[model samples]
Target: MSFIKNYIEQQTLNRRSLLLLSAYGLCGMTTAATLGSGVARAAAQNPKIAWSYRDRTNPYWNSIVSGGEAFVRSLGKSTSDLINLINEGSSEKSLSDIKSLLSRYGSEVALAADPNDMPNCRPVVEAVSRAGAYVSTIWNKTDDLHPWDFGDNYVSHMTWSDVGPSEQTARLLFDAMGGKGGVVHLGGIASNNPAIERLEGFKNALKAYPNIEFLAVQAADWDTQKANQVMSGFLTRYGDAIKGVHCASDTMAYGVIEALRAEGIEDMPIVSYDGNPQAVELVTKGKILATVFTNPHWAGGITAALAYYAATGFFKPSAEPKEHREFYGPTTLVTTKDAQVFKTKYIDTNPTYDWKDFWSLGKGQIKYRS
Candidate 1:
């Protein structure tokens, strides 16, 4: 049961097209501006930006990239001007990439990144600040590292509080399982903040439904292929007793679904996060029970935009209230009932906001209520 099929290829192509089209549309004005004196004025006012992420292999990273690109395009500049780097899942690679960017671009670049590892990302953040580049980190970082400590250079840190949303997903999965059966948990990168929070949510939800036993919990490192293998092994060990699957991201959930299909277990309930397009399709088709939509598109672009604007003195991060310095992004639970609505409203519609508008969206406040 290989989950890597034509559908994946087609979907990847579609996403790439959307990204390129969006970039082209937004970058047109920037191209024009660059030919005139406006380029000089804007360059003096706006900072060049960079976005670095774990890897481009996963749809989640693609979403993050798309968001960042969209934001850059919104700034009336070509997305090509933004430095994009993929760490290929290596913390050393990420650190090295940041160092190179800092050395080359210096304070002219504002950086947004989700580090491959929490602790390793700290020195990278510090280095960016030491070089006078504004930095915003999304999704992965040590708790003790705060933006305020690094002054204006470290603009903000945004993450999703996945625990609440994951618990909601767990309840949906449990209900689909009829409250009594064994389930398997396929989590993300072992040390990731969201992975820990989401798994904690799963455990908390399990306390309410003691009848649904947990068969196993394993780290798949957020890889779909790794998840498929883990789920296959869990199915071999648990057999028909496995009634549900909970994965940290939709990418991994796809693999779990494939594993179930291989074992001829189509009726099992599965819940996942990062409501990527294919996962939404599966939910609409009644193949997946539930997933959490993290809106990575907006998250990626907005964080970069905010950091860039702050670096350019559009807004002073130091003047904003303490809560605004670091916070979580909005997350919504996407169930079968509202999956289509979500796709049409957010995923399909594509975002249309000024690149500089992202700075206002932050307003120096943490908006995640739960």
Candidate 2:
């Protein structure tokens, strides 16, 4: 029942690498540049491609924005052409900045944004469509909204199904604790899609390991400092009873780990999601039991590409099926043994992917409970 050991053994035989496919070779620069030229060239105006995210300080956001830049370069355009709308994790700012862009560019825009909150998606997409712009959104949206319902203007929505891999990490943590221990969790924004799903996964894992009691859980808001503060308090309350920790993201795990280290508790089993560079390094050192790699780079770039392609008339969003409109991106579980391989392939050397192969990196449609 030790999922981490099983994963490592499997990885040793399979040589399991990055979340996405192995690139045999890079696409010729010209070949990739010419991909949407026909449709793009036909338009009288160049649709401005823009990407919006929470902020750039976190290495995770930096990688996402980097992907946005790479996609612009593949189009033979300067990275400056990709306008950045940093919401700084504020929903109001997210709405304001997006509205400003819609007003400025009007119909000649292709935008990929994370609304920073699920409820914000509707208004954001509504404004873009009203301005006659093509828009793609990721990670935040209500279940009721559908790209097909809005014709081609609302291009696509992409979010990873975090439950499965998160559950695997939870099982790994519980099993490592010998199936009996008190575990506390540090989560992202409580209402956020991944946060909600990850917590659900942990709860599901508890159903299997009945003796592993969940001590307490708190929202860290995906902030390291907040996670540190919260974990410090958890230490005060639960202390050594907290035998394990589960974080919704690596950033939170970093904080939790530091808090534990400060208290001289180094041997607790912990797992996190989001295989950021630092988190992968921690995994290699056995500081983190396991983490999931969700490829924010591809998420940022493909979200932009989908909207850009739709705007250029390279594809009609209305013509695609619902599954094509909203889909789940790939998720890979990274543990100690395969951590170095993941580091080499995904972190150390940035592997090039065909951004045009958007769905190839995805898993399937985003399913939700009714």
Candidate 3:
């Protein structure tokens, strides 16, 4: 909370000092010159805020950026003040763009990022750390990576525990199929953490229902078009034998639906993750049996807030508890049963959040499998 107050005060001081100097006809005087330099040096303490992630074409990423913009607005700053570094799903581009910012802003940069993939997280965090910048990450990091390991520069990491939620959705799909049918999965990028865990959850559910047969699982790269193509191929191969579909994300589910529609197979049961508004609506319509809502809006704003506050020295990451440093974001299972309520509360009207209350929505510290 002090961080929010301090940020507002800093902005106020910057404006008030400039106006007072201009009124005194001291724009070119030594006093005004010093004030200007002070503002420039605010970077050394205050930092420039930024969010780096895959492109906003995906509804999930767009919601993430919306949250980031909301946090900027809360600070009495324009949304334009928050820099966006879009990687277009390329880890190379993700790291390069981050390094470019570090070269320009150095320790004055506070970055909240999704490293594009797990392997890219290390290099990205290393670049920021070497430049003495502050960073908070989500969704992609190797188990070996830790904020505490890098000291204060790596502020925190937040991610949803997708396994449980994905399994819950899968069980819903299996039950819809009467626990005995061929189910196929259209997954995200094979290497993505969510993709891996989501598929793992599907597999876990498969174990519980011995009568349900897994026809096939394919990587769709989390792209709607690609998922559509994959689903089409599955139809050609499995046809009426495929009774249910499990998608890694809602975006992919959209593609699967179109593929099914093309073949007049609209009645097939389906489930997915990342509860975009459209996906929630689909749930209400019985189009998608279930999906998981991860609250990317709050995740986006709070991740950036963590980095910004740490960069400005309002909070010390090193002193915070482990749960605050590495934690799971909130996750909600949305099904036909409560999709209407979810749509009204979370989809129709996004909730206002206290960005400074960083860990209120965190489920718990991230747990890794041995």
Candidate 4:
């Protein structure tokens, strides 16, 4: 049957089912309770696929959505077949949207999400699990949560270890500053894992360079305009004392550059994360000292593939090892010396990926600090 026709029929059936359940006093009960107690839900056949994330205003998220569309097309479906649940950086909205999907599709959804923040992962997972749907998450999750604890419903979680890569970029920025001067950092949301790790990485690099003074750091919340305003304020406060800049993402770096340009200050050394195409181009032009590429395209495609396959019973999540359940995504440092090469290889053309070969690109199992 055509997916579109099937989707419409399914929507009708869901509405009817909900009305019947409501009339029978089952509306107040959880999906699990409404069905039965202690009876596990079976894997869904041709489950509806969805990707939940921040938004597409940023290049990083745009790439992520493009990857998801690629994966849906690989399934012989149009890119429009993929559902998007944009939270716009709201954790509450992220969870609510997932719940709404669950109420509609029930045990027939395969979701891949970032949960907007770490703490939100739990509620999102709980909602999916209760509805007997499958989920795979990236970037955000609490250290205490484990996939095994929730069985197959929580398919997997993947995150990039930014500490090492962020440190590499920080060292490059420090070197460009001649290893001694004041540097300020513009970062993402303070609660974000990448932001925390990137800041820690910058601090770690600072240990060896006592002459390089840490002037100040602030969370620009990963918005370009906010970053521009923050950078202007920093210029007013620090002026020529600021010799270098460390930005947590390429989006923020663009704002930093514009802020400098407005003041006729263009040569300040800077390093940022997320080797976005524009950022890579900037590196080649020596505008950015360095940045790290995390391959969001592959991450987005493979994450959805994992949840989809698990929902289809192609692989049993419970049988998989811990490393397969939770792991680190890949990262490569892009510097001025190799930026063009990196762009030619990764940016100019998106690498064709085997969505089913899930772990081939994974770095390793994610390790948490004590």
Candidate 5:
């Protein structure tokens, strides 16, 4: 009877030991799981990004999109990680698209945008700020709206001082025309700040040449088709009076050149902006006298990199110089004299700098001149 009791006691002890070991195993697993989960959360906390733009139809926007894609790729991410919302040329659509991206991505996303219009941009800026999403705007903001006004959420604002380049272009155009006769101006969206600056530059250049007359100033809304039609009408109205043409962008200049060809006016000089592939071709062929080369590819990529690095806590915007935060990108005038050199250096040359380097390029914050 005592032996039986001893056996039963031993069995009970063994069962208790097993239960204790099982509990310890479970506790260890729970601890390990908690640690693993924390690591995952940390990875997810890194900032993701999205960008919105006017449309993909234009080569300008394509360069911008490519830059964004390149920047994201530099982070060891796919372009799909950065949401691209194309507005299809509608301000309302752009505003709505931005809101949708903010709603979906929330604070995890940083946005870089060129809003469709000056006034339509405000609501988008406000919406992203309200959602605690970081934003940077390029080339389309009003003077009153500032990044500082909205706190850290509005990261930066970048715009080119188009006046200098435009004036240089105007001078080139006037010289091409032999400082005499009349020319027509193909301006951008009439209300655009860059458009206004460019026009001011053209007028400023005109001050130097007394014989040159501006036959007409028309708004083409930055569309090639509209520019073509406007040029056609101007040709009809002015005929031989038009000796030269000044276009806000190369795309518009293409239209102007087509009209000039239709009218058998190949000798007329033309100047344009945004030295795109077609523009570069025209410049090489001497069809375009001059054009301003604004590195849209660099601008687009750099803005994304800057915003991404800032959002990821790599650099603080507050510590950066005002110029770095919001200022002009580099611009160069490609006149017939230096067209070949410009093409070799900037146009034909493949970009050597990686997209990630863009963030460091804007290390200083931007300062506005009073």
Candidate 6:
């Protein structure tokens, strides 16, 4: 309790003064004098806050959920107050569940969701907007749709620029392989944005290394067990020809490593993304060549806070610039040398973030080529 209170106080700074001037205050409460009871009105309306995502079996999703729970606490609400809608990997079920929540909460609902699939985001946006509920999404929106198009009800979209970091990790693997060898790649869900970008990153790195051949690439759907099986098949086909492995995520990397271990191969150069805690340990012990951390804590917390703030009339999303509405979240690469420092700051002890910093956020907006 003391740590949380001290953390919130540290986050306040001058933001508290800013809240007094407007009907908003992410740092603290807005006075009745500011914007004439707007905050009180927002509270009275009591918008039901909910977070929707795939199942909680994955460690990454569990971390994301922790961030969501933290945001609920920041709002002076119990974790129970933040409704959870787990889709369990079914796009149809995800849509059905989201619609049900919107119907139940009516216009007084604020939601943060990952669309499960790229195309699934569209119907969600349409439904949430029509129901007059505010929503913020992360990771899986289509390139054609813009949050600004749906006005204030669609608060923002957050995604990580996985290509840069993934490519960087790939290069590390290639260099360790003496810049010449065939490598198999284990990828995530086929149509998912991060999965696609990470695979593209591996291919892009391959372009720079003429001697290196991409032996094969298969979708693990970001599942560990599936990755293990996929990697075992690759080993049977490629054998000693495969010198390294690149995975779209750490979870898949774990499976890939296990498959290699079964064959008594422990030193194969491997690289992956989404610097999960276990992955950092793997990197630390030289099991993985590199990984990229997107800070799910920041991603999940800010995604929920964005919708909640918009619903509370803290800020009008329609008034904010395009970058604020749609932007890429921050990411960092983790290699063996610096893995310990990252573990201390991010993995061991969490960084205290001012989650209300939504507008001037992200590395860039989601872009796609025609």
Per-residue lDDT of 107 in model 1: 64
Ranking of all predicted structures according to lDDT, beginning with the best and ending with the worst? 4, 3, 2, 6, 1, 5
- Which lDDT tens digits does candidate 3 get at residues 280-321? 988999999999999999999999999998888888899999
C-alpha RMSD (angstroms) for model 2: 10.2
Task: List residue ranges in candidate 5 displaced over 4 A.
Answer: 1-46, 354-370
lDDT of 6 by residue, 37-78 (tens): 112234215678888887555668878888988888887899
CA lDDT scores, all candidates in order: 0.77, 0.81, 0.85, 0.85, 0.73, 0.81
Looking at candidate 6, what is the lDDT of residue 142?
A: 88
TM-score of each: 0.86, 0.87, 0.88, 0.90, 0.83, 0.87
Following a full C-alpha superposition, what root-mean-square deviation does model 1 have from the true structure? 6.6
Candidate 4 lDDT (Cα, 0 to 1): 0.85
* Candidate 1 residue pairs that clash: 30-76, 67-301, 324-364, 324-365
lDDT of 1 by residue, 26-129 (tens): 34221111111112222226676778886555778788888888887766788677676666677886887677766655667788888877887788877776
Top candidate (TM-score): 4
Lowest lDDT block of 10, candidate 2: 18-27
Per-residue lDDT value at 241 in model 1: 87
Clashing pairs for predicted structure model 6, backbone only: 328-363
Please give the RMSD to the true structure for each candidate, in Å.
6.6, 10.2, 10.7, 8.8, 20.8, 10.6
Q: Model 2 clash pairs?
A: none
Q: Candidate 2 — which residues are off by over 4 angstroms?
A: 1-44
Per-prediction tally of clashes = 4, 0, 0, 0, 14, 1
| Superposed Cα RMSD, model 6 | 10.6
